[model samples]
Target: MSVVGCGYLGVTHAAGMAELGHRVIGVDVDAAKIATLAGGRSPFFEPGLDELIARHLANGRLRFTTSYEEAATADVHFICVGTPQLGDGTAADMRYLDAVVETLAPYLVKECLVVGKSTVPAGTAARITSMLRVLAPAGESISVAWNPEFLCEGKAVSDTLHPDRLVLGVPDEQAEKVLREVYAPIIDAGVPVVVADLPTAEVIKTAANSFTATKISFINAIAEFCEASGADVTVVSDALGYDARIGRQFLNSGLGFGGGCLPKDIRAFQARAHELGVGQSLAFLAEVDAVNLRCRERVVEYLRKQCGGAFTGRRIAVLGAAFKGGTDDVRDSPALYVANLISQQEGEVAVYDPQAIENARRAFPNLVYERGVLEAANGADAVAVLTDWPEFGTVDPDVLGEVVRSRNIVDARHALDPARWLRAGWNYIAPGRPALQPALVGTV
Candidate 1:
């Protein structure tokens, strides 16, 4: 078996497959990335992937290369390339997926199953089938399948080695058999397999992400109304979360959803719906995007207000830069976006994250990067917890207060403990909750 396109998804999948006892060849177009994997290290930052790559490489089950010819011997191929949002920011760019299938097609000299792990439109399998049938030397021997992955970034290794379920979109019985054989270890260990036609498997991935995004936006949109009525959304969200019908997963009432998947998947789903002439079906997604964007704006405005209605000279500390905790990917990250917005307002901003500082620096070179949380918080007029890193939640407010010039804190991610900050004589503010301001200097 082989895993092609060794980015986040591909590398993790390749490692997981090798761990499952398959002789896996990992392929990528980038020579530098191939070299990194070949040397038993990961090119990116995922918690447990480097260890897996090293263990598998030493055991002789995993290897990487930049050429497609080297992977031609494997009859089972997993296409794990990314489908990023296009330049227009509305539709998915299928160029990488196209290139993978085209490049691998001519090398199909024997019978093979070209399994797609990348998220794509509903009818993409049929188009690829046509392409493979025309391009491959073995013609109909090349079977097309869609096996969309649902691994979260931070917990990718665990998610892959033990997924909730394995989805297989097969054209015929033979394709299903090949997939079941490929994932036999997982299947034997009791992971449910959802076998369906090509289109259903494709749509399931997008549908799941859209629903999760909606829940996040629903709570955030409610947070907006809570601000108007002086109602605390945190309490309201907790109350609603108790109902089994509306559980408390993505109901955090903070900076909504970002990272590689939710943002682009929602937009791409909308674009696909429009192309199918049912644009109105997913119109609410546009609002979801709006509410998520507004959360960033709310943070910027809160910081500006903390600066006495002027952001020109405020020394603001922004914590966390990855879209969320657990991964260093800053693509469409809310924390990084807000930091950039503050910098644009001419505010002195210092940003810090445990794993995302370097990534954030590459994305926005002008913003101040801090080695530690205290460095960012030191001598600041106000501190805003933008990304909900567990460390941000656990950092002692009393210690944080000692370094800052003022005791103003706004928990944009609602990550910090307001009670702890208030007790330390700091004015604590958070979205959807009343301000827990500390006592005045003379009042005590």
Candidate 2:
């Protein structure tokens, strides 16, 4: 089997397939990335992925290359390229998807299945099928399917190896049979597989992302009400999570969703819906996107308030630059966005992340990057924990207090224990939560 586009999705999928005992060829247009993977190194940060790739590469089951010709003889080809949002509009840029199909189609000289795992707008699979029909030398012998991926950033390795469910979009029994054989190990382990047509499969990923984004924004909207009502959004979210129908996932109300997936996926979903003439059906997604962005601005305003109502001449320490924890990806990161917002206001910002500082530095070059949390917090007027990294939550407020000029901290993600910080003589604040004053000496 061959996986086209050696990115987050492609690299993980290729290594995962090899772990399932299938010989895998990973292809990418970037020679540098290929060289990195060919030498058993991952270009990006994903927990357990580097080890998995190195294990497979060492065992001879996995290999990477820049040439599509090396992938020509594979029985199955998975399209795992990225479909980022277009620069001009909210619509997805499909050039990468198109290039993959056009470049790999002519190499299909034998009966093979070309499966798409990239998250794309609906009806893309059928269009790719048509392209392959015309471009492939084997003509009708080539089969196209959509097997949308559901891997999360931090937990991608676990998600790939032990998926809760698999959605396979295939035209016929043969394509299904081929995919079933490809994933027999997972299916045999009792993971349910939902077989649908091309368009339905394509809709599944965007729909899932949109729904998750809506869930996150819904709680954020409630958090806005909580702020006005003097109610704790955390308690409200806890109460709401008690309902089985509501559940607790994506219900946290601090900083709203942002990353490579949810932010762009919802916008792209809305754009695609507009193109299909059902724009009004998903109109609320526009508000969902707005609510998520507003979370960033809300944090900026809170930081300004912490800095005595202005950002000028303020030194702010921002902990966690990744959108969320456990990944180095900073694309559309809310934490980075808020940091940039503060920096734009002339705040001296010191940003730190366990894994994302390099990526964050590249994304926001003007902001100061720190190697560790303590270093970022050193001499800071205020500290803001934006991303929910576990280390940020466990940092001792008293220890952090020793190095800062002031004892002001904003728990933007609700990551720190407010009672602990307040007890340590630090004024703590969070979104949708009341600003609590530091405990007086000798007070319980």
Top candidate (TM-score): 2
- The 0-to-1 C-alpha lDDT of every candidate, in the order given, reads 0.89, 0.90
In candidate 2, stretches whose alpha carbon ends up further than 4 angstroms from where it belongs are: 435-444
For model 1, the superposed segments whose C-alpha errors exceed 4 Å read 435-444
**lDDT (10s digit) by residue, model 2, range 1-444:** 999999888999999999999999999999999999998999999999999999999999999998899899999999999999999999999999999999998888999999999999998988888898999999799889999999999999999989999999999999999999999999999999999999999998899989999999999988777776666789989998999999988888888888888988999999999999999999999999999888888878777777888989989999999989989989999998889999889999999999998889889999999989899999999999999899988999989999998998888888888888888998787777752522211111
For model 1, residues 399-422, the per-residue Cα lDDT tens digits are 998999888888988887777778
User: How well does model 1 score by local distance difference test?
Assistant: 0.89
Worst 10 residues of 1 by lDDT: 435-444
TM-scores vs. true structure, each candidate: 0.96, 0.97
The clash tally of candidate 2 reads 0
For candidate 2, report its TM-score.
0.97
Best by lDDT: 2
Give lDDT: candidate 2, residue 22.
Answer: 96
